[model samples]
Target: MATARDNILKKIKQALVTKVPVPFSTHTETADLFQPSQKELEIEFAEHFTNLQGRFSFCSNQQELTEQLSQLFSSRKWERIYCIDEQIKDSLILNGMNINPYNDLAGCDASITGCELLVARTGSIFLSNTTSSGRTTSVYAPVHICIAKTSQLVYSLEQALLQLTNKYGNHLPSMLSLATGPSRTADIEKTLVVGVHGPKEVYCFLIDE
Candidate 1:
């Protein structure tokens, strides 16, 4: 007597021999999976980012960014904001932010860094190891504050990757990360927990370029 598996295999082989019309044969490969949005890229990014629980802010200029940072710091009483990027540090210092050199990361309340590209479609922040901030600065901190420019925003992941390739040529960074929002994982007991592995709060300051 044949086994149940043999019967299933025989049926599958017979079905394979019976050819049918291909589903949606007229559909082109270039066809978009999602409908095109009328909203601006900035607005779309902000909407998706906020929906992902990311704190999004649009700054008219660098001065506005400074002011917003000051307000946020003051309101949150955040004292230890660790920054490894020299340019960002200079900007903050020039803006009159009291930043003391932090040797221990344990005392750090937040971290400020720059990202490679901001994906408008997914509201993801694409990051590479090119910046002085390195890898640890963004993730180790409880709160991550990313200072991005409007010029860095791209429509999709493919666009971002293409730009990255053009920017870096053959010598790409060893690691590339796309941070969608504040890091969270629902692993243990299926209970959604925030900041268990990475940042609890993610703030993106998009400055007009």
Candidate 2:
């Protein structure tokens, strides 16, 4: 059942995997780097996120995460929700949540999406049009909820690049966005204002799986 095309494709894939160099080694010359533990890293990430113009919250469980967010906006009388097209949409539906996909972000209470990748050091999430079902859903909405997997966390941005290259080969995504917090501007009388062009609230849920 094997054709010449199939054989060649397999060869090419094997070659690429074998030839691609592992850029960094686990061994480090510097011994006193003092890397923080996982708990410390999460705390550091939370601290960095709050320092930005937007308010952020981190949750470990799906039920608690959704409840907390729903309550936050429900208090403000927000009910409609908009979401990007991704795998998480089903999870939301199962939780008795409804999502509007085609409507403009201004019509919804929040936007939810998955990050293309995540950088652990700076607690940043990278979003790309190709990977994240385009950027408008995450960028235009007043509230953005980003769901991330624990396995996707990288030690640094450098490691992220390597993982990306490994996934897509030499050709990279056209737009690689690195988002640490909400969009802000200090234009009016030097007063800080959140959600100028992007989401006012960015909640990150680091899923255990």
Candidate 3:
């Protein structure tokens, strides 16, 4: 006797195998989001952060989120910090930590932003680039921190792609960054070095909704 979940999955798989298009455009749009399982994504994200050279931390709520993040900058003695979006900006200001908006991208020691969603399938954070400040704040700084709600965590890349298409309607941006981990390179002797081109550190503050 197949369970309801099993039956649904079986039907979905059959549709995929047969290339049967879903009648609803919305459902059809969500078809290919699978990548890796949730457990796999957690493992991958943990492993990547652990082996990373620079600073890294993950928080599951606003209190610890603020503490860990504030500690990151304070420990590093980062005086000039910039942030994007209202959440981080408000947090910093309320906590008596000064965070300037990204008027000048290249000069900040760290920058923070909120993400649309986190694709657990690939350990990637999707930046809409809907606002110029958010894009540059994430990319240009030496250290980048992103705040995401746990409710925003989706199982697969297909979910993320579907959400983007539905929300933005096709005018996605000139640049869409799917950052899996910190910017890294194996330049000399093929030895991996993190923070080569972009932020040396990518800290995720996962707020539980």
Candidate 4:
């Protein structure tokens, strides 16, 4: 007269008799893990980024950066560039590029911002709301330009997170974006479409100085 629910519960209880808990151990040594040099990291990052259809460039100093910016602006025809970061704004002015106010993010041809970290292992850039650009500028524009220093490059995602944790401690940004490449999707009839939800083009300018 027992209900079907009782039969299922009884069977589950019987199965529990043979169940065993597994023990886990942790290791502290990572000596066997392969660690690449900074130069090697840069090489890997550039290769991976290029494979993902991203544009990558390097600058040794502010002069080179300004020159690169000039050429980039001319090549992309970016008249109104959305930039919120103070440092980036200064750089833009120094480079003689037009800077659009934050209010006109949607109308701008491209956006330039500073990133928290660049993951060399995956060629990804990490951003946070805590940055000067907040969060909208990076994703709202049709073309996104990220400026990062060579020192900001990390070997892998784990190292990036560890560094962030060490730097921020308990205070972390409300949002973090780990952008790998330009927005792309093949949702409609398996046709590849770019910039459907975000920037169609992404450029990373790595400054050595």
> Which candidate leads the pack in TM-score?
1
Clash pairs for candidate 1: none
Residue 123 error, candidate 3, Å: 1.5
TM-scores for every candidate against the unseen true structure: 0.82, 0.70, 0.69, 0.80
* Residue-by-residue lDDT tens digits, candidate 2, 1-209: 99999999999999987866656566444442446556655665666666664355566767766666667667877666676565777776667655555566777878778877766667788887775657587887888888776667765676677688898898888878888788888999999887787888887877655
Scored against the true structure, residue 88 in model 1 reaches a CA lDDT of 89
Give me the overall lDDT of model 1: 0.87
lDDT agreement with native, every candidate:
0.87, 0.72, 0.69, 0.83
Runs of candidate 2 exceeding 4 Å displacement: 1-40, 100-102, 187-190
**What range of 10 consecutive residues in model 3 has the weakest lDDT sum?**
48-57
Model 1 CA deviation exceeding 4 Å by range: 1-36
Q: Flag regions of model 4 displaced more than 4 Å.
A: 1-39, 95-102
Q: Which residue window of length 10 is worst by lDDT in model 2?
A: 27-36
lDDT of 3 at 177: 72
Deviation in Å, model 1, residue 5 alpha carbon: 29
lDDT over C-alpha atoms for residue 171 of model 2? 82
lDDT string, candidate 4, 107-189, tens digits: 98888889899888788988998762897888989999988888888888878888999989999888888988898899999
Model 3: what TM-score?
Answer: 0.69
